[model samples]
Target: MARTSVRQLHVTVLVLMLGALSGCTSITKHIGASPSPSVTEQIGVDMHYHQVLDTLGPPTRISALPDGFAFEYESFRIDERQLGLSPNVKFLRWFKLAYGTARVARETYTLVFDSNGLVKAFGNAREDQDAGKGLAFQFIVTVTQVVDTRYLDEWPGQHAWGVSMLQPLPVALNREQSLDSGEHGIEQRGTPTSSGQRTLEWR
Candidate 1:
């Protein structure tokens, strides 16, 4: 009897460890899928163009504007589960041998830059929906729920340079434009026009 009891104890411990590993796996996948530095950390009106590139790698799209340039970045993740019910409902259904429909969640992020290569704005959005398999056509519902969406703006100040911070600005022979240039190279297609005006475009 003692031998049998020891075997049972080992089985119980193994089950517990497997359960913990499953949870950790889920958390790890979520963290690994997220974008590093995130939009919030990199969005700043006075931030330089090179700094943005170094932090976020490269944008998904780049556009030349009459004023300066625009950079767009996008990222998304999708999670799918075999149950469309709450945790409590799913647990109860498990005992009854009743199968549940599938549910899916999707999250998205978008960032945009202005003419001077400074961040113009950024947004994060999430959506949740349900999916149905064959023979479960009745359960197939076209229900799309927007979980959340947030937007932030970071336009350059009219005189951001005038407000000095005691330390002298960095100097380079090619840096002809004022701080309004956002420290971007003049080689970019959209250099400031002769009138010193900049333009912006969004889609």
Candidate 2:
């Protein structure tokens, strides 16, 4: 009876250890400055370029236009979730599996200035309808999910316990990627022209 109790305790300890080996982690990262509603309200068309700069701080990117230059202010909020599985046993200790997904929310404000340094056009773009579809962001998530699924079923031996054995992995169905997906949160339309004045388009 004492031997049976010892065996049961060992099993319980092993189960708890295995459970601890697998864990889920969440992380959040904020990039660039997010414009407050009050500050953004102060921006308007025909405002001096310097006014916008002074009001909203520096922009994330700048591009030269035919008539003038353009300033792009962007902010990103990224939330990432990952699940990691590792074997405590010595034989499979080297094996590790990790699956992760990142959701990126972006806000973009653009200011187009004329040669006179006056704002010709201004607009704001927010990632609402189209979020988590970015090339770089989605690519990483897809690779992790696919690899996680495939590796799980391809475990060695006649048992066959890798990704193939699992009918479906726990991946988010909403995560989608496309070749034509706009990498930029704010897209620019048409090419620069040598006309009287050029303006930027926001979609």
TM-score list, all predictions:
0.33, 0.54
Which predicted model would earn the best TM-score?
2
Q: How many residue pairs in model 2 have overlapping backbones?
A: 6
Error of 2 at 192 (Å): 20
Task: Give me the displacement of residue 110 in model 2, in angstroms.
Answer: 0.5
Q: Give residue 179's error in model 1 in angstroms.
A: 32
Residue 7 of model 2 has an lDDT of 100
lDDT of 2 by residue, 76-123 (tens): 666666665656666444444555666656677888889899998988
Model 1 CA deviation exceeding 4 Å by range: 1-39, 63-69, 83-104, 126-203
- In terms of lDDT, model 1 sits at 0.40
Clashing pairs counted in every model: 2, 6
**In model 2, where do residues sit more than 4 Å from their true spots?**
1-17, 128-203
